[model samples]
Target: MQIYEGKTAFRGIAEGKIKVYRKDQQQIKREHAENTQEELLRFERAKGEALRQLTGLYEKALKEVGEANAAIFEVHQMMLEDPDYVESITNMIRTQKVNAAYAVASTGDNFSQMFSMMEDDYMRERAADIRDISERLVGILAGRTGSQMELTEPVILVADDLAPSETVQLDKDKVLAFVTVHGSSNSHTAILARTMNIPALFRVNIPLDDTVDGKEGIVDGYHGRIYLEPEPRVREELEARQAEERRKQELLWQLKGKENVTLDGRRIEIYANIGSFGDVAAVLQNDAGGIGLFRSEFLYLESEDYPSEEEQFQVYKKVAESMAGRKVIIRTLDIGADKQVGYFQMEPEENPALGYRAIRICLDRPEIFKTQLRAIYRASAYGTVSIMYPMIISVEEVDRIAEIVGEVQEELKQQQIPFGDVEQGIMIETPAAALISDLLAKKVDFFSIGTNDLVQYTLASDRQNPKLEQICDPHHPAILRLIRLIADNAHREGIWVGICGELGADLTLTETFLNMGIDELSVSPGLVLSVRKKVRETKLGEKYN
Candidate 1:
């Protein structure tokens, strides 16, 4: 038997014949359809065809995977007809004068890539589904049908990787398990395996070749290992370990309603970050203490034009009410950098991350800033609401924000509009912001460290550039020291501090953050429980003091 280590996406065991997954030619050529009207009509036909196909798949899935899983196809159908998604594809075709296939492909890539990088596991899973539907539409337009796996018997599925679109096309009953060379725990294929109660692994370093296809394979998800043609003795040992892992999984349910307190009696709030009203359900499902980073940029990113104050207010209010008295800190526009909206008409910059963005844009255009502030203030009456400004480095920016906020409140008062108290805070995401955090902390009610950008700026490495992934180290003592600096400054001013970046979800650093006097840690919704578990396990007594 040949053993290979992998990351566990789901915990289970399956021993069966191996089936390798291969897919269709997915290269989409960029071409102009020349006529926008003609291309749009073509896209409509393809979308219609996609909807029909999903309906057929839905019925099939119902028989094979039950209603809960079948609902994915139904949701795919709705997504195919979703106005926003359709508009995105149509707008690209019209503006760029692109072919229907190219439009669908480009728009899908943009949307899917955005969701894939999100911190939330559910949101990440959604990335694959978006790609799946997008590719289906592209395939129809391109007149291409990819490789289809037709299994007559149950097998342990092996692949270099399986796309989200590919998994739904499989016969679930014929798939005993999934083992991929690449994918995350939240990838669509992994989700499918998880739902089916089968073993699944991702990022296995082993080579995937035809030599192993059709051979007996063993997937031991508990210990993150897969065996090709395993010996009988190995199978027997794994079965015993598998049963123990299943028992431990049952204990996972007990984590709910448990306090996020350290072994030494120190407590910290665990919050979830979200982008839209639709994400509130996941936030609550994960049992986050509150919504720490409600990215307000989606209000801009998803809109054709700047969202109206009432439009922004309605969204914020709905989320606030949904939280039902839990803390809701809405971050102001964090556009530019990696997130760009076409309507902004921003002049291209060599380095947008360090250029006119976030607070800079807001300060330059107070009218836009005031509108958002007014909406946030108006929403404050619905629940416990707080407003946070992003990309602030100077005391002057905070002063300007205060001035604008005052103007907004005054306008509301003149109109006799009722709004509740809203706490003000700023993001400490730059070296300059970190250096002067003590001064900045006194001006805001709280401080949220945006470690993703902070690490990039500190290390002079672009966080978005994959080439710098190895070079940009978030664990450098420099980053830890910075967090401690920001946390200390916030505490010195008697204001709470929290991390609302990628590092907040890093379980290894939970104890370090707690010791730094971080009052809260905001992470992706699906990771809330894991971080909470870590927090409860940390023991810091005199060291914290």
Candidate 2:
């Protein structure tokens, strides 16, 4: 057996034939076009076709991966329609009198290379996106039928690396597992594996060439190993392991429709975090009790301009209605940090996360904040809706939000607009907010501790930087202490507290959080069932009391 070692992306076991997945590379030849106008027309038609294809893929991804991960397509659509990108391709066709395919291919190469050479890591990643869109245009120009790998049978698919666009187009059932020659654990492949519950291994320096195709392979995600043409004894052991995994999955399914209560009879709320109205389907499928964190920023991030009050109203209304009376805690626009939109036209900052973000922006720009508040208030008429503000530092910010919300309610009353009772809450993310939670808790009905940012702010680390990924500890004692502190303070004020961040989904600390009197956990839809299983298995009273 040829053994390969890699980092575990997802924990599972699978054995199947190997399939070396190579994306279709369309060769473009430079040719002089007799009519530049006709070539331009051809490029435009292909661009339109590419956009259409992206939309279909996006819809498919929404149902499969939810709106957050599926948003790459929307970004791709914007990149495809970028004026600068279009101008470069058209300029080549007009000036050089080249064929549309050649012009697109050449321009795409230049742009992709330019991005690849950029100093920023995030910008370097954009190089792959640029290439993905460019290749689509060229393929469309060449009359290619599809840009997906066709798998007739289940196999362990190996690749050099996968872009988010390519990974979404893959058929989950047909692929037994994913083994990549190069990719970080946070890569889209890993995220997709977790979401789909598939075995995956990354950074395995395996032969990605066609010669390895059709060889029998085994993926042991639990052990972080890949066995090619395994020995009979090893294969048998792995087969036994696979059977146990299936039995475990069947047990997890049985936990569905069961209460998310601990063995100690402690019943706490379990909710799903979503990014768009499209994610409501996933929320229901996973059987979450409520929508704890409905990120309203996607409406702004995905738009060409500021989303209108009416536009935001429709989205919020659909989500509230879809929840069917379940509590929907919608967080107001948490933009300007990591998620930068060009339309805002804000000046660059040394540390964008600490400067001009979340509640800070909303308080400064009352008109923008009021527009979203009105939409949420209007949607409240459809179902139970609560508002949460992020990046809050003090009680004054909560008071300011209450002031604006009061004006919004008054305006709606004067205009005879129908609205409903909406609870106001602020996120306890900053150290300042956590430190004074007792005072801030009095101003709001609930507190959702955003651990992702809380940890970042408390430790003074950039959460987005890959280099600090290991050093920035989510399980740091300081963060745990802060969570307990916030929960304690909120409890004293007779207000509920919830954790709506990455740490909430951690199974290792499930009992610790339960003992701390955490009221709720808001995690991704894929994790709801697993966390429920953890909660049901824990005996908090017996262990701690």
Which candidate tops TM-score? 2
- TM-score each candidate: 0.72, 0.91
Which pairs clash in model 1? none
Runs of candidate 1 with Cα error greater than 4 angstroms are 2-19, 25-138, 141-226, 231-249, 464-467
- Give the alpha carbon lDDT tens digit for every residue of 261-354 in model 2: 9887989899999888877887898889999999999888878799999999999999999999999999999998668777887898876777
lDDT of 2: 0.88
lDDT of 2 at 288: 95
Query: Mind sharing the TM-score for model 2?
Result: 0.91
Q: Per-residue CA lDDT of candidate 1, range 351-393, in tens?
A: 7778989989999988898889899999999999998999988
Residue 485 alpha-carbon offset, candidate 1, angstroms: 1.5
After superposition, the stretches of candidate 2 with alpha carbons farther than 4 Å from their true spots are: 29-39, 93-99, 117-121, 185-193, 541-545
Q: Clash totals for all models, in order?
A: 0, 0
